[model samples]
Target: MNIARPLIQLVSWAILVSSVFLVKALANDSTQNLSIAVGWSKPPYVIALNDTGYEVELARQVFKRMGYSITPVYVPYGRTLSMLKSAKVDAALTLSENTATQTIHLTDSYIQYQNVAISLQSSNFKIKRPNDLAKHSVASFQTATKILGKAYADAIKQVPLYVELPDQRRQVGMLLNGSISVLVMDVNIFNHLHSALEPIESRQLVSIHNIFPPSHYHVGFLNSELKEQFNRALNDFQASQAYEILVKKYHIFQEALSTH
Candidate 1:
């Protein structure tokens, strides 16, 4: 090859290598960034499909207070812990010690879900407690089995027909059409979907059973330092006016901390 041509080729290759390194350095700046695994479709808590929801906004605001930005890694509710354990994500939203194994550092309780059993009023389901679900067909939000406590877990095992769905919208529809006898969902989610998918006059069709105790949630972080930072930021943010506004923006109520 001509000397001049070879020299130009060498310079071009070096420049390309330098650019690649630069891009990676910027992209992998873990020190100033965090990737959190969030549920893909629990609207209100997480609508990770579009990345706008209560949990998403909460994480963004809390992490921003900690001098870092956040990127939500949308996954099924079941994958949040695994993703965090595998180092694929810096943290996982909407998880707690009960919903996890001994793998990561869990932040303080930052959110709560008032999980309840809902059914058609016509069904007359005598579901006054978790065990009552055993006699009926039930569809609940995915990960409910693990997060809803031991009593709920043991009760679901006795269910004649039980299923877990990632999005409650379908389960809500199932409950509405009498396909399923009961739906275990967050109250806010039930109300939100009910409003959107049915007529106001049809609101009386379902009965919401406030049987399950509220599920408190925390963020699982890969490292203790991050956990500490996040918890501190979470506490500070939850005490600020901005957090009040955020709660109002999402219309969170007493039982619907994870609003829809």
Candidate 2:
């Protein structure tokens, strides 16, 4: 009976050790790592330096709040949608509602973009409406036609000289060099690019018009459950001071205008 008691005690100790290790393993498994697709070198949104930007920080905070870790996968803007559709990434950030595919679930708007038409102050251009763009040479970001809506797309079709470039920087350069009479881009992005220019050059550029309405961007997710969780977390974030902090840090509301 003495040997039997010791044997039973040994078994209990072994079970306790096993349970501890099992719980630890399950804990590790419970902490999920989410991958998010973001555009490369899109300043104030996806800065490539340390993979830190407004959207990057926002996503990090949102997922962290939801008890998960996030990894941002940088890709070109055009490829982000395909990557999401193919399940290459858990979600894609900074996508407008007009651009989101039907198959993927979209979360609430986490960011807003003020897209505008820019031209040189010397050009004497006036772009009060989409139709007004038909009279000028234009350069715009890729997929902008679809995202800007059918009216803008139809207007661009009427433009005799129109080109869609993949890089915002190139569009800015083209506008400065007089290669394109007008450039369309987010106000923040234009400001970011303009800051790199010489003071003399910056003074000459101007945002002619805010033809396109402000676009609200959402995160696209292939998994519906993840989208629901993100929306809840995003709503909570918007109600918190953290959201205001991010907006101010990024200068999100500042309209696109000439530096001068």
Candidate 3:
């Protein structure tokens, strides 16, 4: 009698194990099949919230529909590239065209924009030309100048006093502190943080008249094999209506669209 009872219990456990396996298989089948890494939120682009921010979220959804498991990594702009170089990450969310040419393989242009140097109104310094900066101190990130050029970078490096800030937001703070006479960064990044740092109305910041050409940003790939797969997926994503939805959802061309 006791042997029969033990046998029945073993049979019941086997059935439960089989059911669990079936459920796992079904779940796996339902999910897409790719692995990706998207960099942290820089805003209006790569957002790093618990919920994917606008553009990054769009990228996530686009890849998910195509079969991808996105791993979002929060990193400094410079570190983002380091990760890519080390193969620790697949691609950076959004980087300038210049960066693409200089660093990673870029996809077709998804977005483009002009970036400029900005300085607080209280400051007497004015930038008429790149050379005008010679007299004053500048706070800039090392990664930023790469987009500008080795010449610009060399010039910055040559300045009598140049403060290197790892974070763009910190550079803004440095501007306010009078530690540096000027701050150089993406215009959009400055605009996004300006309000939080100080009243936009109270402060007078100027964007130099000579524009930095509208630089394109796109999905990047480090490994060529992965790049090809992503390129195909990216093209497929572009052809789908989902792509348009993403552009609108993230307000990708906000600076241009806002005028309308």
Tens-digit lDDT track of model 3 for 1-260: 47998899999999999999999999888764543445444555554567455566666766675567677777765676666667777676666566565447876665554556666565645566566666678876556566766656766766788865656677777877777777776555565656567885766454443434565667677755655666677778778897888777755555521110
TM-score, cand. 3: 0.72
Each candidate: what lDDT? 0.81, 0.83, 0.63
Candidate 1 ranges with C-alpha deviation above 4 Å: 1-31, 99-102, 254-260
- Whose TM-score is greatest here? 2
Each prediction's TM-score against the native? 0.82, 0.85, 0.72
lDDT of 3: 0.63
Give each prediction's root-mean-square deviation over alpha carbons: 5.5, 3.5, 4.6
> Candidate 2's residue-wise lDDT over 43-146, tens digit each?
77778679888889988989887888888898878788888888898889878786556688888888877788888888777678888999898999878897
Task: Arrange candidates, best lDDT first.
Answer: 2, 1, 3
Tally clashes: model 1. Answer: 0
Q: Tens digits of per-residue lDDT for model 1 on 63-151?
A: 98998888888887788888888899988988866755556888889998888888777777777778777888889977788777777
lDDT of 2 at 132: 91
| Winner by lDDT | 2
- Clash count (model 2, backbone only): 0
Query: In model 2, which regions exceed 4 Å deviation?
Result: 1-27, 99-102, 200-202, 258-260
